[model samples]
Target: MKNFKIIVLAKQVPDTRNVGKDAMKEDGTVNRAVLPAIFNPEDLNALEQALRIKDKYPGSTVTLLTMGPPRAAEIIREGLYRGADNGYLLTDRAFAGSDTLATSYALSRAIMKIGDFDFILAGRQAIDGDTAQVGPQVAEKLGVPQVTYAEEIVDIKKNKAVVRRRLEKGVETVESVFPLLITVTGTAPACRPRNAKLIMKYKRATTISERQNVSEDYIFMYDDRPFLNLPEWNVGDIEAEPERLGLSGSPTKVKKVENVVFQAKEAKVLEADNQSIEWLMKELISNHTLG
Candidate 1:
């Protein structure tokens, strides 16, 4: 069997599901500093799929790639505990205010710098953007086939990947040749928890920026163990064009944000009887609230 080189695209996004009144800033931008940052949930599913493939083939490697601020290195360290071989943190001031298009452009260029890979897996959509465009955009930028909403990767045979896709109405299976991108869906299996041994081994893994700010305790460890040094790439490192990065590259702009609060106008208390239940059903049908 051929040893596969799989790259999982993960993101450290604000936990939007627990958004509060202050989640958005006055200017309509997200208040990322106030929100709790976490590993994108669907991206965890993508990691699980990649790890499964690694288990099937000996010598296979699973590397994570995430684009965010210096703090985003947390996602890489999280992946290490979950069985990824290594990871790259793409960070720079130029990538600060990027939209989906610019984000994908930088990611595609970074992937190119990493050289050959059999698969690029990503989440179907990020909780922050929720646009579900980055993975397909990356595929288009790389000129490769893409499979979105993938629930599971069935198998790889003859350099082709069979993937099961989850749709609104039903499921569909599709196949794509090697060197393609796939975005996994939330319906896929949940990622395995961190291993105790892996945590002990990689607890001190730090990027160059992190290492510089930390105490002198791990200075000797960096020289003795190269694997403990996580890779951090800037715009210059990936050779991305300045014009196509950050706010300049982003075409989509938010106009305004409106907060809408819903309140119940009225309520009715009914006896727990068959007649009351029948009347409630009829009222709901008439109001088109149910059918």
Candidate 2:
């Protein structure tokens, strides 16, 4: 099989499952400082898919591309530890408050800059915002075919790939040509653990912005080892239109946020008998909580 150039789109998302009181700001944006940042789960699945391709076809490269804050470069190192060849971090104030549409536009432009990739893979949705729209939107912007909810890449030929998809009701297997975009679902195989050797190899990898804050001694090492320098691109680096970035390009607006705290007014104790279960079901049906 011919080697493929694969780009995996990853994201560093706040662990929303552990959200605390400070998780959201007054402006309705996320307060990432208070929340723990994690690699998006499904994106790991996407990365695993890319790595599989690299494993099967020697000389194939898996490049990770993510758009977020400077701190988000952590995920790039995470990818490097998991077998990605290299990574690019897209960061700038212009990308702040970007909704899915703006994010897709920015990523599409970055993909164009990277050029000549055989495949683009991303998570089905980000946990922070479960819209699941960015991957397809990027494909639309790039004018390429897209396969969503991909469970596995069953096979790959010189110019095409066969993918198994996890659907709402069942699974589906389909084939698509190269230069395709795929959004991997959580149903896919979980990512392999970090390789100790790879971790040791790339532990010092830092983006340019991150390098600025480090010690002068490490700066020399970073300069000597080019791979240790992860690329950090800003809006200007991508040549994106200022008007079509960040909040200005986002059509969605958060008008309001309400916190509803439910309090238990009463409680009833019941047995596990069928009669009790039937009565509970009927009560739920009467209240429209079940039918």
Write one digit per residue (lDDT tens) for candidate 1, span 129-172. Answer: 89999999999999999999999999999879999999999999
- Each prediction's TM-score against the native? 0.90, 0.89
TM-score, candidate number 1: 0.90
In terms of lDDT, the poorest run of 10 residues in model 1 is: 253-262
Model 2, 1-291: lDDT tens per residue?
589999999999989888777776776666778988999999999999999999999999999999999999999999999999999999999999888999999999999998889899999999989999999999999999999999999999767899999999999999999799999999899999999999999999999888888898778897688999999998888899978889999999887766544886777989999999999999999999986
Clashes of each: 0, 0
Clashing pairs in 2: none
Q: Candidate 1, which segments miss by more than 4 Å at Cα?
A: 21-30, 263-291
- Number of the top lDDT candidate: 1
